[model samples]
Structure formats: structure tokens, C-alpha cells
Target: MRRVRYYQYGGPEVLTVEDVDPPAPQAGQVLLRVEAVGVNFVDTRFRRGPGSGSIFERPLPGRPTGDVVGTITRVGPGGDARLIGRRVAALAEDAYADYAVAEAQWLAPVPENLGAGDASMLAMSAPVALRVLRSAPLRPGDTVLIHAAAGGVGHLAVQLAKLLGAGTVIGTARSARRLDFVRSVGADVAIDYSEPDWPDRVRAAAPGGVDVVLDAVGGPVLQASLDLLAPFGRAVVYGAATGKLEHVPVVSLFALRSVTGFNLTAWRRANPDEARREMDELTDLFAAGRLRATVHAGLPLTEAATAHQLIESRSHTGRVLLLPGGLGPGAA
Candidate 1:
């Protein structure tokens, strides 16, 4: 088996592809033949270490741990044989390999028509967006605001909010060019966050104030999101893309408003059932042609360093994928 591993925390150069014997699944686990691996911001963060979002607490046993989607090939003790040969997506670590182990419960069936790359996208972002929206208690007629609305999680979140009956969905992007794509994805209005008074513009677009706010660009953005929320509204803080530190005002909760933090990794651990449920919904949407993934670029597994560079550069749009078979000259 071949897997990408990095023993030290650094740049993309740290990731190396090496041949190793594939490990057999232990009890209650299933072996999956890798199809497509999802490259997330956290994956890059973990690879680069302390500079990016709390990379491993102290010293992880080894570097490189993230999500993947693959097909089941073998079932271990306490695992159901029915899972063998099933196409599924799972939130497992060390997915940038040809094979990985997954607990059956965490695996969600992939739709027959969907390809590996698409399944890989849904494996992480969709589930997280669904969980965050649901946790914020979105209801019909509620106005929702999402920051970084053109990125991986943001784009899907725009559509998910619409499907959940959210009204006047507003998204912010630093680039005006991406606003068109954001609106096409179901956001009723799109704003360029580069503007000085973007939050005020969001309020202007949504007269009643946003009912729920999903913000990944934290720091001052989090504070602005709180100001944009309606009375009794909830603000879900998922990521801190700004790299700016923040001190939350606990006293603000008295205004019948609430602020909560949600990480997909932590949420998945706490609510597997909820995660699976949302995944199922996402699959249905994909199959029905209601959900689409925006892939910025695809590089060969061996060229993982290039993918990391594109993501870190922030010049790319949507999620970047890795094809284990390697890339052609025309490959992005």
C-alpha cells in the first residue's frame, strides 16, 4: 500500500509518498480501497504545524491525519459482511493513501451515480454545514448570513440553507468575481467583504437583521456577526480564517442572543447519527442534481505538495482534490 506521510511539521514539501504494508482492519473496523481523498484546510494546518490552527496538541504520534472516502474491500471481526464491496464515505484519518480503516457506523453510503471526488467533498464540508445550520436551529423564513461564502464549506452551506427554508440567504466573499457564483448557488444576496462597511451592507440587504449567522472568518468578523444578528438570534462560529485573535463579550448573551463554536471533527465525535443523517440528505441532493461540488483543481497524489500550495495561496476557488493515479500534463 502507498500512503502520504510527514513526520515533521512544515510546508507541503514535508508530505512524502512511501510504500508500506497495508494494515488489516481490527475488530469493528472495515478496510476500504481508497478512491478519492479530500484535502481540507485543517489538513494543511496539521501538516504545517503551529502556524496553522492548533496543529496537533503537543506531538502527534505521526504527522498527516485527515478525511477520505473509499470502497469497502474487507470486513474485520465485529464488522458486518454486508459492508464489504459497498461504496461509502467516512471521516477517517490518513486518507491520502490507497487504503484506510473505518468504523462501520461512521460510513455513509455513496450514491451510485456520484464519483469518488464528489463523495470526498461531501464527506466533510456538507456534514459540517448541515450540523452547524441545524445547531443554529434554522427555520422557515429565517434569514441566514455566512462568511467566506465562496469557499468549500461556504458554497455548499448556501444551498443547504436554502433547502432548509432559510429566506434571504446572504454570503460574503472578498472577491467580487466570486459573488456571481455565490448567488447562483442559492444565496439571495452576496457582498464583497473587502468593503469597509460590509457588515452594515449585510444589514442593509437584510432589513430585519440576520436570524442566524455562520461565520468562519473570526476575530472582528465574529464581533460584526454578533452585531448583525437579530434579537434572540444564534451565531455559529466554525473557523478563524482571519488569523486574528478575539475576546468574546459574554455579556452580550443577555440580549437574547447566543454565540457557539462548532468544529466538524468535534461535532462528528459527539453526534454520529446526526452526521449520517445530514450525509444522507446531501447524497439525495447530489443524486437529484440539486447539489454540486466546486473543485478548484485536481493534482496527483504524489504531487500533494502542489495542492497544498494552491490552498495556502488562497488563489484557488472551491475544494482541491488528489488523484492517486497521478496527473497528466493537462492536469490542474
Candidate 2:
């Protein structure tokens, strides 16, 4: 089996694929014949560090961590044997590998109608999207702003916002095409965040102020989003992709504006049953036509470096996938 690994942290070039014997799953884990891997920006951050700050404490010889959609070929002790041959999606152990192990209880069954790429979102992105939106006080008719709104979770957040009764969905991305993709996915307005006066544009669109913000790109962007919130509005911070999570300012909190931080693992641990319900709801939404997963590109496993490059550069509009089991559904 081929797996992506990095001995030293640096640029995309550091990631190298090596052929190795596949390992068996440990107790409570299931071995999967990975069909596709979702390439995420966080993998790039982990690849560039001996310690990727407070969020990721990755060590040497690190591999990408991501969502994987595959078939359960074998089950380890404590795992259900009946799951063998079941198509499912889970956050994989050493996710970039052609074969990986996943926690059996944490995994979700992939609906027959859903493709591999969309199923991958069910593992991580879609649930996060749904949770972050719900983290804040999101009411019907609220105006919502989704930063990086054309990326994996952002794209899904845009649609879910509308479905959850957001009156106006404002999306922010770096490129024209990304803005268009956000619009295509039901955003009421799309703005280019790369512009210096982008917040002004957002202000123009909302007129009063944004009611809710779903932010992953922290730092100045997060601060700006917080600054633009209307009275009684809320902002949910889920990630710090900019490498800096900002501190809330006193002024931003005035006028009843509030900020909340969310971590997927934390949320799952804190609200196990509700977390499971959220996952099921997202999966069901995708299974129906209510949700759509926009895939930017599906490349071969060998091009893991290129996938990282796309994510790091913010050039892709949605989830960039890797085909580990060759070209299948949602893979080119």
C-alpha cells in the first residue's frame, strides 16, 4: 500500500509517498479499503511544523489527517464483524494512506445514493458546518456571513444557513470563481475577502450588520467579522487557518455581540447524542437533494503534494479529494 509521509516539516515538497505493507486494525478499529481522501488545509499546517502551534502537536514522520470514504474489509476485536463490506466514512488514522484504520463506533454508514466525496464531508466538514452555525444564536431572518465560503465546510455552511432559516447568506472567498460558486450554492451575496475594503462591501450588503458569522479563518478576518456583528448577534470560531486565533476585543462585545469558539472533538465529547443526531441530519440532508458537496478536484494519491498546494494557496473552490482506490464515484 502507498502512504504519504513527511519526515521533516516544510513546504508541499516535503510530503513523499512510500509503499509499505498495510497493517491490521487494533481493537475497536476497522481496516478500510480507502476509496477517497479529503484534502484539508489543516494537513498543510501540520506538514509545515515540528509543532503546528496549540491546535496541532504533530511530530516528525507525520501524515495528512482527513476524512476518508471506503469499505470495511475487516474488523478488529471489539468491532462489529457484520460491518465488514459496509461502505462508510470516517476520520481516518493516517488518512493519506491507500488503506487506513478507523474507530468503528465513530464511523458513519454511507448512504447508497451518496458519492464518495459527499460521504467524506459527512465524516468531518458537513457536521462541523452544521455545528458552528448552531453554536451561535441563529434565528430565522438573521443575516449570516460565512468566511472562506467556497471551501469544504464553508460551501456546506452556506447552504445549511439558508436551510436553517437565514434570511440572507453572505459568502466571502478569495477569488471570482469562488464567489460565483458560493452564489451557485445559494449564497444571497458573495464578496472577495482579498480586497482591503471587503468588510465595507459586507457592510454595504448587510446595511445594518451581520447577525451571525461562521468563521474558520481567524486573525484579522475573524476580528473583522466580530466587529461587523449587529446587536445581539453572534460569531462562532471553529478554526484558525491563518495560524493565529484572535482575542475578542471589549468593543466587539459591546452592543450584545458575542463570540463562541467551537472544536469538533470537544463538541462530540460534550454532546455525544446530539452530535450523533447532527451527523445523521447532515447525512440525511446530503442523501436527499437538500445539500450538495462541491468537489474542487479529485486527484490520484500520488499527487498529495499538489492537493496540499491547492489548499494552501486557497485556489480550490471546494473539497480536493484523493482517489486511493483508483477512480470511483466522485473521483476523476
Candidate 3:
């Protein structure tokens, strides 16, 4: 089996492709003949360096990209035999390889309407979007603002917010192209956050400010998101892609506004059953044609470095994927 690994953390240049023996499924796990792998910003973060108390706690060379979709080839002891040969999406570690082991509990059957690339993309982003929307105090006709709305999770969040009855769905991206893509994904309005007056534009669009703000971009954007909230509005902080340190100000507590941080990894760790339920809901949405994942690009597993570069550049819209098993070039 072939896999991508990094001996050191720095840039995309550190990624290397190598052939090695495939891993076998352990107890309560299943071995997947990986068809598609979802590349996310977190993979790049892990590649750069270890953050405090994060999964990347060390600088050890290893494979990244955990979101995977494929057919089950083997089931370990205590795993359901029926899973063999079934197409499923799973949250697995080291999924950049041709074959990866996933815990059976994290696996969900891929719907007939979903392709391998979309399924792989949905494995992580959809569930996180669903959970975040569900956690917020949302009401019909409410105004919602989503940061990084053209990226993997934000795109899904836009559609889910509308489906859940948000009256005004506002998305922010760095460029017109990204904002246009965000609008196409069900955002009622899309604005370029790169402008110094982007928050002012959001306020003008929403009138009395937004009722809910989903922020993945931190730093000054986090503070701006907090300021854009209406009275009693809620802000959910999921990621700090800006690489800027942020702290909630005491003044943000006025007007009954609240800032809450959501970490999907921590949520999954704390609530496995809830996580599975969210995944099922996302799958149902895809099956019903109410939701779809936008696949920006698909490359060979060996081109993991290229995928990372694209993501880091923020030039690609939607999810970027990697096809294992030598499925390269024209896969997209």
C-alpha cells in the first residue's frame, strides 16, 4: 500500500509518498479499500506543527487526512460481517493511504445518491455543520452569518442554515469568486471579508445585525463576528484559520450576546452517539437531494502535497479530495 507521510513539519514540500504494507483492521474496526480521502485545513495544521493539547502533540512523521470513503474489505472481530463490501464513509486516522482502518462505530453507509468524493467530504464537514446548527438557538426567519463560507464546513453550513429555516443566510469569503460560490450554495448574501468594511456590509445587509454567527476565521474576524450579532445573538467559534490569537472581551457580554467555541473533534470524543445521529441526518439530507458536497478537485494520493498547497492557498472552493489505489489525474 502507498501512503503520504512527512518527516518534519513545515510546508507542503515535506510531504513524501512511500509504499508500505497495508494495515489490518483491529477489533471492532474495519479495513477499507480507500476510494476517496477528504483533505481539510486541519491536515495542513497537523503538518505544520503540534498545537497545545491537539491530536498533533508531537513532530512524529505520519499520514494525515482522516475523512475517508470506500468499500469495506475486511471486518475485525466483533464487527458486523454485513459491513464487508459495503460502501461507507468514515472518520479514520491516516486515511491518506490506499487502505485505512476505521472503527465500525464511526462508519456510515453511503447513500446511493452520493459519490465516493462527496461521501468522503461529508464524513467530517456535514456532521460538524449539523451539530453546530443544532446547538445554536436558531429560529425561523433569523439572520445568520457564516465565515469562511466557501470552504468545506462553511459551504455545508450555508445550506443547512437555509434548510433549517434561516431567513437571511450571509456568507463571507476573501474574494468575489469565493463569495459567488458561497452564494450558489444557498447563502442569501455573500460578501468579501477582505474589505476593511466587510462587517459594515454585513450589518447593512442584515439591518439590525445577524442573529447567529458561525465563525471559523478568528483574530479580528472573531471580534467582528461578535460585534455583528443582534441582541441576544449567539456566535459559534469553530476554527482560527487566521492564525491570530483571540480572547473574548468583557464588553461582548453586554446585550446578552454569547460566544461559544465548538471543536468537532472534542464533540465527537464526548458524544459518539450524538455524532452518529448527526452523520445519519446528513446522509439522509444527501439522499433526499436537499444537500450536496461540492468537490473542488480530486488528485492522486501521491499528490497530497499539491492538495495541501491548494488548500493553503485558499484558492479552491469546496472540498479537495485525494483518490487512493492509483486513481489519479482524471479522477476529478
TM-score of each model, in listed order: 0.90, 0.97, 0.94
The regions of model 2 sitting more than 4 angstroms off are: 50-56, 330-332
Candidate of highest lDDT: 2
Candidate 1 or 2, higher TM-score? 2
**lDDT tens digits, residue span 1-332, model 2:** 99999998899999899999887998999999999998888889988883556666587888678899989999998777899999999997588988998888679889987887788898889989999988886789999999999899999999999999999999999888888898999999999998999999999999999999988888899888887899898999988887885778887697898889899899888988999998899889988979988788888899999999999888898889999767765552
lDDT of 1 by residue, 1-332 (tens): 88888888788888888998886898978898876666777667667666665523335433354456677999888778888888888867677778888777677788877765567766677888788898898999899998888888888889889988998899888666688878878889999887889988987998778899998787788887888788989999887865554777877677789988888768778876777777788888888878777777777778788988887776666677776655433222
Query: Considering lDDT, which of the candidate structures 1 and 2 is the better prediction for this target?
Result: 2
Query: In candidate 3, what are the lDDT values of residues 277-306, reduced to their tens digit?
Result: 888888888888788788888888888999
In terms of TM-score, which candidate is strongest?
A: 2
- Backbone clash tally for model 3? 0
Q: What is candidate 3's local distance difference test score?
A: 0.84
lDDT of candidates 1 onward, in order = 0.78, 0.88, 0.84
Q: Order the candidates by lDDT, highest first — what do you get?
A: 2, 3, 1
Better of 2 and 3 by lDDT: 2
